[model samples]
Target chain A: MQLALESNAFFWAIEYLATFCCGLLGGLWAVRKRYDFIAILMTVWLTGLGGGIIRDVLLGIFPPVGVSNKGLVITTLLASCAVAVVYPEVDGLKWTMATLDALALGLYAVNGTQKALMYHTSGMTAVFMGLITAIGGGLIRDVLLNRVPSVIGDSHWYTVPALIGSVLTVFSTRAYARGVLSFTGELVCDLLIVALVVCLRMLSVKFDWKVPGAIKRKQYRF
Target chain B: MQLALESNAFFWAIEYLATFCCGLLGGLWAVRKRYDFIAILMTVWLTGLGGGIIRDVLLGIFPPVGVSNKGLVITTLLASCAVAVVYPEVDGLKWTMATLDALALGLYAVNGTQKALMYHTSGMTAVFMGLITAIGGGLIRDVLLNRVPSVIGDSHWYTVPALIGSVLTVFSTRAYARGVLSFTGELVCDLLIVALVVCLRMLSVKFDWKVPGAIKRKQYRF
Candidate 1:
């Protein structure tokens, strides 16, 4: 499974695209916060690569690709520079930026689950890893800025799709391992899961769908 | 160095003690925030073990001791319970708790440096790892609660001691590796570094020492 994923150029393309999008998002966030240049650059890199680094470290993969991959590092720096220069103009493309962000989230979820399964972690752990990969960077960014992580504090449907995609990926991987699903079948399944997550996220955002908070007003009792 | 540290039961004892102290601090913070029992427990575990886990993961250590070691996990839980039940009483020992916390910070710094050196990381990386090990847990805890990490925001001399200790540890380890220092000498040096950090931290707190912020009043320009 690892070999198949590694050998697939499509997977690499998606991963890089996700990194770039995440970097851009992070850079924009830093700019909005009025952070200086160095901080903006660091924020971009962390937001783009933090999750993968955390995942790789957990799996005992040394010198995580975030730091080791020159291309990805360059991508983040480029994102920093781009956001720094194009801050005002980019505001007009909010929806476009958000769509890309959603795609990145889905890709990260798929990639994290694949990596966890490759490391031979249990299905439950793999799902957890996937969720972390998808949201960890944003979580770190929020924490660094001293804000409650939106995933934890907001009533958004962000984590739900990631969780669902991860579970589906694990199931497909299991089928592939058991020879009930072919390599191509597994890849297709993975792509579909990503699509499903992106769709769910986008729809939720468009329709203002929300996850219930710890206490709904109707359920509150003095 | 790795073999020596691993073989010495004293190293393990200090590491566990540091973990327990960190857990207690984290639990106290959570309780103060009025978090629920589950959040308090999670906070304790993260505060106690987060730094070591991050260090080990960065060094590619699988199943970090924090999660894999039953004893350490139990220690954090014990800390959680203790803080929950003895919150008010613990406040009376403020000075004592602060002293222990300083010691824990120093020990974490030493252990992180040692582990990074064991993995053949460069001296600079080792020092960085040491700082991370010493303060990563607190940073994570602060972030979770939507506050700026004290290490970054507070004018206190918290991180300075950890940085100094890490740098000193690296230098001593280098000397030891060059055969200029005996095994006993190295161990003594590590203990002295820990002591130095503890003293520096405690003294800073006692004297209200401060790290300069981004702008000093005299240097401020409108």
Candidate 2:
């Protein structure tokens, strides 16, 4: 059965956009890693859909949106191919990638939190899933490419923004549910969360505000 | 809610054993990669419980057993620490590792298939999930460690054995459902599938039967 998307069309639309951005980034990664065509395609699929799949699976939604949503699958594929074709031009535009990453992070964080709440998950779980949906695909992509996940290393405050966005989504949505927040207020909350994340991400990138000491020389094996 | 396990005591027992094996392997891998204590612990948890988590999520079972089953978590942690302690002594025994890997593969394949069938999944999906359960954790471990997944590269017929076991489990269980196979016959089928996989794995290891040209030099980027 299809996921119940009628109730949150706006959120899902953002999710799709985020998915495409992740897909393109994955393709870029495949190029950077010098992987062949098949590997690139596989990476694209994994990166584009991995987070949503993780979210859906955790929520006990069968035949995950990643698997059943043909439109999304095709969109990610096309995004991947397009990025692959334009890799040379895009490779030099570091600012563009950073912007896209921030935007995707914001979109995914909000969308993921909303979906988790829809499934009646606890607020804590919804926040966790929001982070997963925002960053899980890129983690998988990096892992598959045989690199330490950037999020755990040189992420430069990547997760903090997502976390803030997720927390905002969860608390605001709860307020709305309890009738403490108006519909307009709820809509503002959503936009505000997204804006906060994107802004935080851009500021982090500009300022290089990385979490210190997370990068350590390997010791104490096992 | 907990998974429906009342009808499959034997399967669950084997699954636990398999989980222990994977946890140990994860510990060993972490050691090989020279990760610190916390990273090792994370690896152990991921490798031990990741597959079951994936399976349960796909089947729409929320709050996965990995999160809910405290005993399993403790068990995996203990298993990982034990492996880490004894790794130097065990390092010389290559055959031992191959044997354990084979056994874990067999156990997970059968357990995954049975769980999928319990959920009334299509045979194809069941088989796919069975393979996922059997290998997904290892893939995660390798990826996190920045290596190509062994199943994709150096596995030497890994998927073949898992596929065979999964296929047998699905078909035999289906037969049992139709009353064409007696309960005793179904049990035999289960045992046979596991045995077949383990044996095939060992034989492939002995013969060093790598898949034909699945390995290619990375050339066509993006």
Q: Write down the lDDT of every candidate, Cα atoms only.
A: 0.80, 0.76
lDDT tens digits, residues B7-70, model 1? Answer: 5888878767777777887788788989899999989998998888877777777778779989
In the range A41-64, model 1's lDDT, one tens digit per residue, is 657888998888878776767867
* iRMSD for each candidate structure, in the order shown: 6.5, 5.9
Stretches > 4 Å off in candidate 1: A36-42, A53-86, A89-92, A212-222, B1-53, B56-114, B121-128, B134-138, B144-146, B151-222
Docking quality band of candidate 1, CAPRI definitions? incorrect
TM-score for predicted model 1 compared with the true structure: 0.60
Taking the candidates in order, what DockQ does each have? 0.17, 0.16
TM-score of each: 0.60, 0.59
Candidate 2 lDDT for residue B192: 85
Model 2 per-residue lDDT at A88: 62
